[model samples]
Target: MASRAAAVALCCLLVLAGCADSPVPTDGADSPSATATPGSSTAIDAPPAATPKPDAVEVEVIDIVDGDTIDVRFPNGSKDTVRLLGVDTPEVHAENDPTEFPGVPDTDAGRNCLREWGERASQYAEDELAGETVTLSFDENEPRRGYYGRLLAYVHVDGDSFNYGLITKGLARRYDSSNFQYRERYGTAEGIARGTGTGLWGACATESPRTATETPIPAADGGPPLWVSEIHADAAGDDRENLNGEYVTFANAGEETLDLSGWTVSDEADHTYTFPEGTEIPPNGTLTLHTGSGEDGDGHLYWGEGSPVWNNGGDTVIVRNGSGETVIEREYGG
Candidate 1:
C-alpha cells in the first residue's frame, strides 16, 4: 500500500511540471514589458537639417520706379536706384523708341500696348516689393552700376530671386543674359513662360521676331542717333584716384556720321561736358568719354574733372543737342 501511494505521488509531480506555462519568452514580444503595454515608446526621431541661404546685402526698398527698377535705402542713411539685372520690362518710359521692343509692331498702337503691359509689370512689383526689405546680389562679371547710375543687382525677396520671377511671369525679357550667372536657368524659365503666354508675352499683341532686312537710316530731323552702349562706373580701386577707369561709352547706330558739336553730356547732378566743335562720330563707331583729363583721341574723349563725375552709387546720363532737346538718356547705378 505504501509503495503504490509513492508511485502515484511521483506521477502527479510529473503531470504538474508538464502543465506549467512554457518558460516566459523574456527576449521577444511575449516579454512582460512588451506585452504589458504597446501604448508607450521612449525613442524619438530627429528632424532633418535646414538649408542655408546665400550671402546678400539686405536693403529696404524705398520706392518702385517701374517694372524693372526701384529705389532702395541702405543701413547708412544713403539711398540708391536699383535696376533689376538680367531683365528688361516693356518700356513705359521709352514710348517713342519703338525699335527697342523687338517683337512689338513699330506703330503707335504697338507702343501703346507695350506701355500698358509695362504698367501692369510696375503694379505687380509695387504690390509685391514696395517698401519691403529685399536683399541684393551683384554679378561678378558685370558692372556694379549701369551707365544710368542705378545699382545693377539681382533682387531677392523671401529667399527667391525676384528678377527670375519676372522672367517666368513674363513681365520682362532677359536683358543682358549672356554674362549672367543664371543664364541657363533664366533661359529655361523663359521657354516655359513663352510657351504658357505668362505676362507681357500674353497680354500684349506681340509679333514674331522680325529679321533686320537693311540698316535703319538715321532720323531725317537731326534726332541724335546715339545711345549709351557701356559705362565703367566703378574702378579697380578708388574711383577718384583712378579716374580713367570710370567712363561712359556712346555708340552711333545710325548709317550717317553724327556731329556732336555743341552737344552737352550731363549727369543727374548737372555736371555737364560740351563736346568741342569738331567732335564727329562715324557711323557704327563708339566714343568713350573718360572722367580724368587726358589728350582726347583714339575713340576717347575726356571729361576733365579731378573728382569722379559719375556716381558709383546711382545717376543718369543725359545727352542733349545744342537746342536743349533731350536726345540720349541712359540711366545706371544705385
Candidate 2:
C-alpha cells in the first residue's frame, strides 16, 4: 500500500509540472540576448556615435577683424590672416565712396550713412564669429593668398559658408572680382538680398541729415607735440608703385615754433621715420611726410622704403621721443 501511495504522489507531481505555463514568445529583439563571456559584462550598452565634420582643413579663430576678415591659427600652429572669399564690406575707415556701395547717394551724409552701416556690419560679424572654430574651403582656380598676403577662403561655421551668409544678409557684396568659384550662386543670393532690402541695403537707403563736416574727426589725445591731422593710406594707384601718394599730415597748433629733434614716427610694422636734428615747424604751420625717397624740404620729408610703409588695411602710427618714450599712439581702420 505504501509503494502504491508513493507512485500516486510521483504521478500527481508530474501532472502539475506538465500543466505549468509555456515559455513566453520573443521575436529575438525583446529577449535578453547577452551571453555572458569570460572577462566581459553580460549587458553591454554601446555608446552613441559622435557628430561628423567636413573633410576640409579646420582652424581656430584668433580674431574677427571686420565684416570680411579674420585671423586664424592652423593645426600646424601657424597663424595667418584670412580674407573672406567672394564678399566685400563697406569701408569702416575714413575713406568712403558712394560709387563703391550701390544705391547710396554720393553725398557726405550718404557716405556717413554707409559708414554707419559698415559699423553695424562689423558688429554683426563679431557677434557671429567671435571665438568660433571654423573650417576653410579654397577656390581651386584662384591663388591661395590675395594682394595683401591674406589667405583667400570661404569660412565655414558649422558647415555653412559664412561668406554666402554675408551676401544673403546684405552685409557684403558678391565681391568686386570674378575670381571665385561660387560667383553665380553668390550673385543670385545678393540679388535676393538687395531686392528684399536686407542689412546695409535697407539701412543706408536714405542719407543721414548729419553731414561729414558736422562730424569732424576727433583729435587723438596723448600724441606727440605735433598733432596728426590726416592720414591718406590708400593711394590713387598701386601703393607699391606710388609710395609718395600715401602720406600723413601733422600740424603745429601752438603759438611758438616747435623743434622735433630726435623724434621718430613708426607704424605698426616698425617702419620708423626719424625727424632730423634741425626739424622745426613754425607756429600754426603744418608738415607732411611721404613714404618714398624724396628731397627733404621745409615742411616735407620722406621714409625712403623700397616697398610701402603704412598698412592700407589699417595701422597704428606711433611717435617716440629721442629717449624711446611713446609720446604718440594712434590707431585707425582701413
- Give lDDT tens digits, candidate 1, residues 33-115: 22211211211111011111333456788898899999887654457787886678887776634465446577888778778
TM-score of 2: 0.45
* Tens-digit per-residue lDDT, 122-172, candidate 2: 887789887888766555435545556566667777656777778867788
> Which prediction has the highest lDDT against the true structure?
1
lDDT of each: 0.66, 0.64
RMSD of each: 27.4, 27.9
Q: In model 1, what is the error at residue 141, expressed in angstroms? A: 1.4
**Model 2's lDDT to the true fold?**
0.64
Cα distance off (Å), candidate 2, residue 75: 1.8
Poorest lDDT segment (10 consecutive residues) of candidate 1: 42-51
